[model samples]
Target chain A: MTIYENKYRITYEAFSKFSAKLSKANDKAELLEIVQKHLKYFFNFKYFRVLLKDEVFLKSFHVFHNSNNSPEFILNEFFSYEEDLLKNHIPIQHSSNGEFLNNYDQKLNLNNGKLWAWYFKYQDLQLCVSLISDDEKPFIVRDIEILNLLIDSFVTKYQQIKLKNRLHQKNVNLKNAINVIEEQKFQISKIVYNQKNTIEQRTKKLKDQNSKLAEISRLNAHNVREPLSRILGLLEIAELYEEKDLKKEIFEKIKTSAKDLDHILQDIIYKSNNAIEKLSSKTPPTK
Target chain B: MMPDKIKIFLVDDQKIANFITQKLLQTSNIDCEVLAFDQPIQALDAVEKDLPNFIFLDLNMPKLNGWQFLEQMQKNITSKVIILTSSSDPADVEKAKDFPQVISYQTKPPSREILQELILG
Candidate 1:
């Protein structure tokens, strides 16, 4: 096979493997590890850095790097340079001789070697990648093209991860709402059951009271009539008497009969008051 | 001419009731020999020896109530009973009708008109 054909085959195979690993990454940390592995395999570099900012949270920045030392100095200079590039709406592909090249070289102590810098904006994210090589060979246009394609796929995978996280959070909220509704339903049914029991008890009490009143009514008709009838019979006999002594005797019997009638009336009143007190003393059910 | 003497028996728990009933019978001036007993046992003993033509009985008593007296007399004696009681209850009046010897039910104190009608009948 020709050398050019073999190079194309190797690039295709590497990109396919990187995509497979990227798809398996579940979070930001895992995605960064997969990106670092692939980038290191594809290029020769003494220093590599990725600086990213999300438009939604402007102050928060993510920095990923593969250097033994911290890349804070390179990050500070990269953000300052990024402002001008964004104003001009220009995508950057810079080597050693480019403007702002000295800033990265000085901060990273690159010893005047070749550096490849790339800037890309994908939806809400601003991304920058930088690589420093001590070799004299400059980066080719083909390398920039491959870097841009990889960045595009990385942005898409990151957005998918964000969407999946949001969907999971919404599901948790919905489950909590359903649980609250079930608890309310159970409480309402319990209240209804308690109310039904109270009503049944009250009805039974009222029925007993009604039967007692009926018994009192029976006594009024039967017992009270007895004394009243004696009084009436004595009056009938008194009307027929003429002799003074006999009339006096009839008068005494009439007085005794009248007293008996009065006593029966008092008994009826006493029983009726007792029934009233029993009814009034009953307490209503509380919540 | 005086009518033939009609023998009458009176039984009651109350002494005043029996006295008043006896006086009312005498006031009526009927040609009758009336015998009064406050205790139903004494009246029952007299009734077993000589059954009277008519009996006036009170229902509410301490022992041997008027109904019991009637039950005892109903088997052998053919005397007519007039239930003279303080109770004017229709249930008591209806129960009195169950005895074949009971001719009438009257509430106390027995009036002159009722005594006269009973003696004449």
Candidate 2:
């Protein structure tokens, strides 16, 4: 088999194993282990790290086949390069810098190269993916293309897996919401039981208050009208007199007092009408 | 029988506007006999007896709006019609373009200079 055919078979077999593990994997740790295993075997990188764009600290696991020395220096260099790439219009791959520009270098870095870096782009995230390998075989351009295709597939697969997890969580949340609603329904009767006595007490108190206020208002209106009627009647008689100057003065006084009383009565009537109108609009008119 | 002077007819509903326009025409260097009319129908009747050289008409009125008055007056008299009104509406502004007799549309109580210019220019 050609190198491509070999790599394809290896990647396919590993993905099959990972797909099986992905179904049963409960936590991130189990999922990560399966992921690391498949990624290491298939992509053949010295170091492999998955840095979530949302995370403050990058989360990655590395495996070096040839050397015991860790590729921590390579990651430090990559962090600045990644920031620059995002800020400027620079592409991912820089030959001098310890990173991969396109998808191919990522696989090359993992397999046999001493230094390699890659980034996976999504809607709201940029994953700084990298690998370090020390091998005689130079990274071929065709292999890089295949690697680019492979990572793209991986990103799609990753999204699908995450969506499935979200759906599962959503089902659990819906179940919890239903349970809470059922519990609330059971407790709702008790709330109604408690509110009934309080409502009755409040209603009785309000009625008593309303009656007392009405009685006071009636008494106040009676007291006001008696004096006002006497003044108004005298003014009306003075208005009918033959003397124009005297008649005008009394007429003006009576007009002012009469207007004040009319205003007060109209205001009370208007307020009552407004209240009734509001209540009627809210409640469907019963035929 | 009439004096040797150019007679100008002012047609507008606003008495003050007509008064001001009359004053401007009187003070203007252009020697003209100015007659003011608050009622457009009365003005139309007066114009038939002796048509003036210029007729300043207010665009908006109660009985007969300036446009209709101009149409009726145009049928009878050969006076140069000029629209004068406080209305800044585009429709009213565009009235001058449609009416061939209308020399210009002046925004209310036009300056004495502009009034003189309208009559002489």
Candidate 3:
């Protein structure tokens, strides 16, 4: 193949590999790792760093990659330059300084390098990406397109993971709320059932007491008056007849009836005492 | 035809109640012929034949209670019935309301004043 066609063909092949690996990524770490591995094909940079925020999830991701090393994934950590870029919504291109490189020049093995950074807003996600390079392995303006594609694929997976976590939390919360309500309903029904039992018991006891009281009142009236009426009648007759007639005819009957009345009253007192004792003996009902 | 003197029948389970009531009738100076019977079964037969002016019937009895006597008397009940019980129980008084022939309900010891009012008045 000719050199021009080879370069175009290799570029297409690298992008296709990056897209396929990014699509298979399950999480944020996997997405960043895939991008770090394939990004070298598109550019020859010493370091590439990205600060990304998902506004919907309220989470920020920091992916820092040193060429020929595994990518480091830091959550919600941003450099001063990255913060400045985010605040100003601006882009920067300057000669490499430790401040722009977040004071990591000794580890990155860089001196007299060029630094490039840009801020971007895409569909509720804000991203600021920084690349460090020197004359030996220079990063051109055209390489920004490949960086943009890598960020887009990484963010898609990150947002999905965030949404899945949130959905699971919501489901757990809903289930617990339903369980609490069911437990409360069961307790309330138990209370109601106990109350019903108490009411029925009280009603039955009151009926028994009422009937007993009625029997006592009715019995006393009849029993007490049976002899009492006779005594009153004899006295009335005694008052009518002469004193001599009273002694023989009325007095004997009066004595017998008065004795009978005394016996009936004694019986009534004993029965009333027993009834009162029975009423007080039962157990008290619960609230 | 009406009798020459007022006839009062005393029907009760207690012999003493009938005796006391009969004596009260004598003491009251209300000139009435009093027929006293402890046995209500016999009293009902006598009452049916005599057809007295007033029948003073006691409530509680052995074979024939005052209510049973009243029911039996439904056929030949020409006389006025006076319910004479130990106590004027509201139940007894209310039941007496159903009998049109029962003119008065009196609680015993048969008072001369009550007897005088019933026969003479």
Candidate 4:
């Protein structure tokens, strides 16, 4: 509606476009470096610094900035009222007269040329923006709004890059675990196959031994009876001279033993014949 | 009661087996005279001199097997033979019947019942 309002709206639109330019990144270091470049180029700010306090319960802060040199804040004064300031739980960006601000200015010899600061409530850390124009009174309100806009966009980009790095590392670890498991499975299957082959070989060997034992037993039984039968028969005839009455009983007993010899011979013949039959069957039928 | 004059012959390749069988024969006929032979040839050679009425023979042997000895003894003596062995073969039984003098076949240290019937039946 008004010219000043129109100019403010245009600046806001430009800042909004810079904020919307956040993209997925691979690492935290690269994301922070890009945010430093964006503050210098997009916002046209001479100096910008971001001090991030460790969110994992460590009371230390990491500062990323356009300048490589550390700020001249006295360590004791900076930490003196830090606890109470953090516990207040409100955005400290609007506090131009806070204890930390006065302490920081005194330590840095700062006369304030467009110095702006914002302390994010979520992270107890400060974002400092300055025009670096000496001898000019600081445009604190206007620059603080600009610094807040830049910090918002930077935080969003940092989070995006951190999430990307975590997901990428997780994917790599998962793939390595799967490869290890698959190799183990392959080795186990090979062992099982070898064991099965060994069992089959042992079974075949036992069967062969059993068949050989059977053959030996049969051969042994065959050879023992003939001489025994002959002896008994001769004894029977011999008994006629010594014991005439016992001759008949000896004859009957000899007859019974002869029958046993006959039975064993028949069994040997049957077994040998069966062995021959099996051997013939195993031989591929000749035309 | 077997007569003391009844000559009993023991035959086998293994010396221990021959000794055990000879001992068993002594228990049965207290007065019988027992003669042990390790080789088939030696037994066949003394068949006439020994004139044993009761002859125990083993079939599995080195030079002359029981079957060969039986054939040889058939020509020399009318002695009765009883096969003593650790075997149980049907082929052996069939061969035993082939010899007319082979009257009975007895298995190892022949069972008391079988020996009692053969000697005292």
Q: Give the candidate number with the greatest DockQ.
A: 3
TM-score of the B chain in each candidate versus the native B chain: 0.94, 0.91, 0.93, 0.88
| Model 4 interface CAPRI class | incorrect
Ranking by DockQ: 3, 1, 4, 2
Docking class of 3: medium
True contacts kept of 2: 0.00
Candidate 4 stretches with Cα past 4 Å from truth are A1-7, A41-46, A54-85, A89-116, A121-139, A142-146, A220-287, B1-121
Q: Give the Cα-based TM-score of candidate 4 against the true structure.
A: 0.45
Task: Tell me how many clashing residue pairs each candidate has.
Answer: 0, 13, 0, 32
Clashing pairs in 3: none
Over the stretch A1-287, how does candidate 4's per-residue lDDT look in tens digits? 99756756876776665555455444555555455445443443333444444343322222322354433322222332344344553433321222244423233333433333345644543432223322323333454566666667666675666567778889999999889889988999999999999999989876996889677665544454444534444453443344765556445545655665677677777877897798789779988
Instruction: Please compute DockQ, using alpha carbons, for every candidate against the native two-chain complex.
Output: 0.30, 0.00, 0.51, 0.04
**lDDT (10s digit) by residue, model 2, range B1-121:** 9557888998877555565566567766878888999999999899999788889988668889887887786665678888876555565677568778888886653676887777778
A1-287 in candidate 2: lDDT tens per residue?
A: 89788877876776667667666755455555555555554555544544445333434444343443333312223356556544563445333323443432343333334545566677755666554445443443444554565456555565666677889999999999999999998899789977998999989987996897676566456434533543444443453356876546455645555665676677667766876686579778788
List lDDT for all candidates, in order.
0.72, 0.63, 0.79, 0.59
By lDDT, the best candidate is 3
Task: Give one digit per residue, the lDDT tens place, for model 1 in A130-158.
Answer: 66565443345566766777788888997
Candidate 3's displacement at residue A162, Å, is 2.1
Chain A of model 3 scored by TM-score = 0.67
| Highest TM-score model number | 3
For candidate 1, write residues B7-26 as lDDT tens digits: 89999876667766776888
Candidate 2: misplaced stretches above 4 Å?
A: A1-27, A54-78, A88-113, A136-139, A164-183, A194-287, B1-121
